[model samples]
Target: MIHIVFNEADIPVLQQAISLDESLQGEVVVIRDDYAVGPLDHTYAGEGREARLNWWREVLAGGDYEGKTDTGEVDDFKTVAELVGTLRRNPEETIWIWAAQNKHDVSGYYWLLHFMKEFQGRVFILYLNNLPFLSEKGQLFYPIWLHSIPPKEFLKAKKLARPITLSEFEVDPDEWIRLCQEKKLVRILEGGKKLSQHDADFYDIDLAKFITVDWQKASKIINQFQHKNKHTTGDAFLLWRLKKLISDGGFDTQGEIRNMKDFEIKLKSQHQAETA
Candidate 1:
């Protein structure tokens, strides 16, 4: 069996779980790419590669999209290619995909399906987004990431895994394409629809407003909003957007914004003038 998961950060926890259960033993593959905030073209050809590179060059130039950039040299394609090769060679092998509803995991799942057309293998998907697991205190938890589940909780999830039927795969790939076309910053569940970044709680405007109020330090602003807002974004993502705001003259920086805590923000005169 082969195990594929989206984030490499989750590998240690997964490995620890596998150690507990010998039946879960398999090589864990992490395709290190963030499909959530970048342009995606589904084709694995020359034109598609160029399109991806061009898109990454624009979006990830800010250097905070998980610190990954798509070089035109096919460096990022190697991991997925190797996985596809392994699947092609082992026709009867069972491939297990550990995924969630997040764009990163879902996109990776779709990319794998694109290459599975020729493999006569049985594919099992452990979709963790909605899987309910029993806690030690017998509380039920639905986790967004596999790392959130305890080792024992993962064992409970393992029993509920199911194979991806041919009919499901055939239709899912189309849905994946539709999702890609949406080009959202985040994929969130809403009103029975998987929508894109529309529900993203953090925005450039809000950052500008917060930073301008007392010219507070970035750390204070982050902490303030984290407590005030119901939906909070990570400091890195907020800092990334803050940098973009600076670049676009919405905010002025007092120092090198090397880290989220490194800079203090002041509202730009130009932005204030426009708003006034």
Candidate 2:
């Protein structure tokens, strides 16, 4: 069996859960890319390899993406394609996808399903985004990811997951393709409804209010606004967005742009004066 997850942070919790059961051991694949925030043109096999590589190259072409170049990400895309191709070749292996309802995991899940259209083996999705979980206090709550659950609870959820039916997946593959073409950003709520982020700029404005403050303090203030896990963008992603704001004269900053601690952020005087 092969288990696929959306990010590296998810891998350790999953690996620890898988370790508790020897039968669940298999290669854990992390997609290593965020599909939630960018153009996903030619992201699947139907669009062809050249187009896919071109899209990835253009996105990673400039600006420090966690300090990786366009060449590096192009290679990374090839690595992912090759890994999926290997999984496609094995008809006997069952593929398990660990996904959530958020755009990050949902987009990856749909893309993987699009690629595995020809695979003969069973495909199961442990969609944990809304799965009911029991806490140490024995209270029921829906966890946004398997990592949110305790290790022992994760193991139990793994056991409870069932194989997705052919009929079900058949109807949704086209929907996934349509989603890839969408230009607007969204967050998936419970029951698969999407909340649009078309006009949201609160993060940039709110964080910029913390003038002459390190990112640590800024992030702490910003975190208070993150009420839901599905809608929460990571501190790194927020910082990247903040950098763009700084570049656009929405804010001003001092020190290394890439290193959060090395810089202090402040609202631009023009914007500040307008607000005042």
User: TM-score winner among the candidates?
Assistant: 1
List TM-score per model, in order.
Answer: 0.77, 0.74
Q: What's the true lDDT of residue 3 in model 2?
A: 88
**Model 2 CA lDDT for position 226:** 55
**lDDT (Cα, tens digit) per residue for candidate 1, span 10-76:** 7887888899899998988786655554445454677766776666555445444434554333354
lDDT tens digits, residues 1-276, model 2? Answer: 888888777898888878888878888888766655554545554554455545444433333344353435434356557766776687678778888656677766766676666663477878875668787678898876656666667777786567876765786677665665664433343356243333225355555544443334334434553553225565555656566666776555666655445566664566575884
Among all candidates shown, the one with the greatest lDDT: 1
Model 2 is weakest, by summed lDDT over 10 consecutive residues, at: 193-202
Candidate 2's TM-score: 0.74
